[model samples]
Target: MAATLPQDIKLHTKSRTLELIYSDQEQFELTAEYLRVHSPSAEVRGHGIGNGVLQTGKQLVGIKGLEPAGNYALKIIFDDGHDSGLYTWEYLYDLCQEQENYWNRYLKALADAGETRHGNMIAKG
Candidate 1:
């Protein structure tokens, strides 16, 4: 079977979510934080296997824009100055399908590392 591509894409800046609509009436809403932490870029994914870096403090990340990469993928420009990862159609679809599982795993990893999604915040009085 061929890979499923979205029929329409909506970037909701206010909500910081990317909505993918399919012809079958299916839709998936992915947050910027989720996409940022799961980026396929070498910076996030690492140079090779088992060296991936954990993205922290991305709870407030937002999508700046989306650019199509040829006919196979999307180049997502994030508000945090990250623009390296190319989210292929297949990968995006997989993310949509396994969002819950992936999110749970990410949360678990963060907990294991004693990290917080809020990253390092400096309180001002």
Candidate 2:
């Protein structure tokens, strides 16, 4: 079965979030940092299984714009110059459903790497 596509996609530049509104009254707001960190591009996802690169220093990143990629995905242009990923409808739906879990994992990974979302190294305590 095909994934359900959002009926509307809105980019809130001031808030730096992408809002997805579904016909079933479901809505999701994804932060630019969240989207950037979870980008499915080879730069973030890597060229193969595992070996994924960690994205840091994107706390204030914002979406510059978005372009539809055929009928399946969106090509997001970020202010930080990252416009390589194609965010498919299915992948986007998954991101929405797993937001909290994915966010938590990102935070943990950042801490483990002594990195801050603002692109700084965590000072040793």
53-92: candidate 1 lDDT, tens digit per residue = 9999988888889999999999999988899999999999
lDDT against the true structure, per candidate, is 0.90, 0.89
Which 10-residue window of candidate 1 scores lowest in summed lDDT?
116-125
Judged by whole-model lDDT over C-alpha atoms, candidate 2 comes out at 0.89
Displacement of the residue 75 alpha carbon in candidate 2, Å = 0.6
Displacement of residue 71 (Cα, Å) in model 2 is: 0.7
- Among these predicted structures, which one has the highest TM-score? 1
Assess candidate 1 and give its lDDT: 0.90
Model 2: per-residue lDDT, tens digit, 51-105? 8999999887888899999998999988888999999999999999999999999
Candidate 2 weakest ten by summed lDDT: 116-125
Query: Could you give me the TM-score of model 1 versus the true structure?
Result: 0.92
Q: In order, what is each prediction's RMSD in angstroms?
A: 3.2, 4.8
